[model samples]
Target: MLDIQSLRRDLAGVAERLASRGFMLDKAEFSRLEIERKLLQTHTQTLQAQRNSSSKQIGAAKARGEDVSAIMAEIAGLGDALTAAETALQALQTELDALLMGIPNLPHESVAVGLSEDDNREISRVGLPRVFDFPVRDHVDLGEKFGLDFETASKIAGARFSLLRGDLARLHRALAQFMLDTHIVNHAYTEVYVPYLVNAESMRGTGQLPKFEDDLFHVPRKDMEKLYLIPTAEVPLTNIVREQIVPREQLPLKFVAHTPCFRSEAGAYGRDTRGMIRQHQFDKVELVQLVEPKDSYATLEALTAHAEAILQALQLPYRKMALCTRDLGFSAAKTYDLEVWLPAQNTYREISSCSNFEAFQTRRMLARFRGENGKPELLHSVNGSGLAVGRTLVAILENHQQADGSVVIPEVLRPYMGGLSALRPATD
Candidate 1:
């Protein structure tokens, strides 16, 4: 939500900025509505004043034992007129607010204005893709050697699902635990356990509702209201402080949570339908930061680096891309996607996304902080996947495959795997 004063003062400039994100702001309608709002507001105030003065006159007439019927009739008519004006003012204000709610966040000046992901600029690269001497096998092939059974998973669930067995399943669990431990212990983030199911307001606070409703999985129980399977811990964790005014000392609140994310994949019927790359459910350790407005931009960069730390520690090759205006989401002023290299695909794939929502979400949630003068002001919100556990597992299997169809565990994950050095094929 933008400051209404900013919208009123710089309507033209604000409209143009929103246009870059494909939002059609009706300035003409907004201007007309603004005019109506002012006129109705003034009329209501004037009528209220008239009613107050008339009430005083009626009281004096009653005390003097004079004829009060004429004055009483005038008061009754003024009450009706005042009530109508107040109703009209409320309607106009509601219309104006609806228009504003549909508008996208204004892009930061540093964000490049472009139409699609092709326009995104690459910022940095880490590690290097490993060279294999033999015909390389993808994760699906390597994983099957150690009991990754898609057939069994499909039987239990449906498509876009997999069942890991033996050491493979343990590796998957270890990966999530390791990621959570790293984010909490080393990254200076408070470990949080958030609800995997959230209410509609939580979704709306993070700008996931009203526009992306079809992309979510909603579960409605008979006795309780509908709840959405959280697409990411970011939604639940960040909304914890929604509509709150935190003390200035807690300006930079860093939180990390691990949760199973569910996405409907409604429009993506046939894309990445292979393996675990695009699953109905996946584990991700999300990082969320609510900080002072002035510190958000720098915090975004630092948060991205923290995500890169996990990939670096695992020795994964990856690159960062700066999302252009068209590539940015409705809530993000700017975004960066970190794509990790998968040896099987022979290319990089998105494993994490980081974004700074520069007061866009804070305003909607009424999330604020006390300033030096003890006045409330909107805080900035940012969140990202430190790393998606499923994709990370895929990258490790494909990149660290051994000649004998075994998987060499990354040194960082060795402890988590109970000192296991390699994942060997079980003689079932």
Candidate 2:
């Protein structure tokens, strides 16, 4: 949520910034609401003061052995009006909160001012797309020879589901394991295991609810609050400090989690439906960091590099992109998307997104740390897919495919795969 003070102080300036991201600020509505709020609050305060003064007069009259009936009656009459005013003030604040919660975070000054993905700036490219003498196959075709079984997965679940058997399944698991180990050991992130299902408050803390509710898989229970299947481990890992104020020494808390993510893909219908590129359930190793506000932008670059390190270790060619203002995620003030090369598609596809949400998420979560002045201040949040396991698996299969329909395992992942070098077709 935006700082209400910022909005109150410069509604026009905030509105203009929001307009750059294509959000039309309802200036008239906000102004009208602000007026109503001020009036109700003032009226309530006046009534309260009158009640206090009249009660004091009533007390003095009683002490003097005089009838206090009139003074008492005056105080009594103010009671109903005060109650109504207070109620109105509460309702106005609620409305204001709802409006604030729905607004996207303002873009950082460094973010490029553009309207779409096409305008995103490419930061750098690493490695080179492999040259294949034989015909290139997408992950689906390459995995089919080994064990990518979609028909069976669909029967068990439905569309946007996948089942890997034999070596292919091992490769998928190995990718996730490799990512978790890399972040924990080399990147110095503490490994965490979090719940796959979370409450609505957790969702809202990460800026996933109230706006993207349709994109979530909600589980309704009898006489219990509805729970949501996590769309990414980012939601759980980042919310670990929600409503908390950490000590100053614990300024930068880096955490990583390998978890299965669920998404309804509400707005992604008919896109990337052919393979594991888009799935209802996918495994991902997520990275999250909580840091002092001033250091967040620097941490974002380092976080992006940590994710890039995974791709480098896997020997995959990829490019880093600075997302344009319009392409930025709802909670992120700035974002960098790492797109790995796909040999078959002849193009790069996003496998990870590193973002600096600044204090946008912390404000909503009330995640803070003690400052030098002995006051609690909001912490900035940074997170990314160290690598989306499923997509990374796809990239490896397509990028490392041999002429004989075999997929060579990346060297680093070999340890997790028990020194297995390649995935070959299984004989019946």
Candidate 3:
């Protein structure tokens, strides 16, 4: 949530910044609520003061042997009025909070000003797309030979599901394991195992609830709060510090986790429906960091490099993109998307997104660290998909595919694959 004080200071400026991200702030409603809140609060305070004054007079009159019935009655009326005003004030405050919660984070000054993905700036491109000797096949076509079964998956579940068997299934697992080990060893992130299902507060802390609830899958409980399936490991990893005040010594906390993420894909109907590019269930090795404000931007770059290391190690061609203001995620002040080259698609597809949320998420979580002045201060959060495992598998299959229908495994993953260097179909 945005600092209400900032809005109070300059609602128009805040509104303009949000407009760049396509959110129209209802300033009139906010102003009305603010005015009403102030009036009610002042009236409540006045009532309390009057009640106290009357009570004092009643006591003094009793001591003087004078009737205090009128003063007592006046105080009783003031007390009732105060109760009503306080209740109304609380309700208005709740309304203001809901409005603030729905607002997206303001883009950082460094973020590019644009209106869509087209306006995103390319930071760098790594490796060249391989020259193919024959027709390039998408992951769906190549995967069918090695046991990628969408038909069986749909029969058992529904659409947008996939079941991998044999070498393809093993390769999928290897990708996630490799990414996890790489982050833990190379990037020095503490490996974590978190619940795939989290509470609503956990969702809200990570900016996933209330607004994007439609994009989530939830498990209903009888007479209990429903739990939400995390859309990314980023939720649990980042929320580890929720409602916490870390010791100053632990200024920065880095975490990595490999987990199966579930999303409803509510708004992405008919998009990437052919293969593993978009799935209701996908595996991702997520990286999250909580750091002091001064180090957040620097941490973002380092975190992005940590994700890039996996692609570079696998010899996959990819590019880094700086998302425009309009393309930034709800809670991210700035973001970098790493799009891996897909030969079959003849384009780069997002395989990872590294973001610096600044204090946007921490503020919502009330995740804080002690400052130099020994005061609790909000920590800045950074997170990224070290690599989406399914997409990484897709990239490897397409980029390293051979004319003979065999896929060459990267050297880094050979050990994880029991020294095997390539995946070939059983028919081969």
* TM-score against native, each model: 0.92, 0.96, 0.95
lDDT of 1 by residue, 21-45 (tens): 7787899998999989999999999
Colliding residue pairs in candidate 1: none
Off by over 4 Å in 2: 49-71
Which regions of candidate 1 fall more than 4 Å away from where they truly are? 45-71
Expressed as tens digits, the lDDT of each residue in 1-428 for candidate 3 is 78888999999999999999888999999899888888988988887788778878988999999998887765666766788888988898899889999999999999999989999999999999999989988899999999999999999989988999987899889888999898888789999999999999999999997799999999999999999999999999989999999997976899999999999999899798899899999999999999999999999999999999999999999999999999999999999999999999999999999999989899999999999999999999999999999999999999999998889999989888889889887763
Question: Candidate 2's residue-wise lDDT over 296-366, tens digit each?
Answer: 99999999999999999999999999999899889989999999999999999999999999999999999
State the C-alpha lDDT per candidate: 0.90, 0.93, 0.93
TM-score of 3: 0.95
Q: How many clashes (backbone N, Cα, C below 3 Å) per candidate?
A: 0, 0, 0
Off by over 4 Å in 3: 45-74
Question: For model 3, which pairs clash?
Answer: none
- In candidate 1, how many Å is residue 161 off? 2.8
Best by TM-score: 2
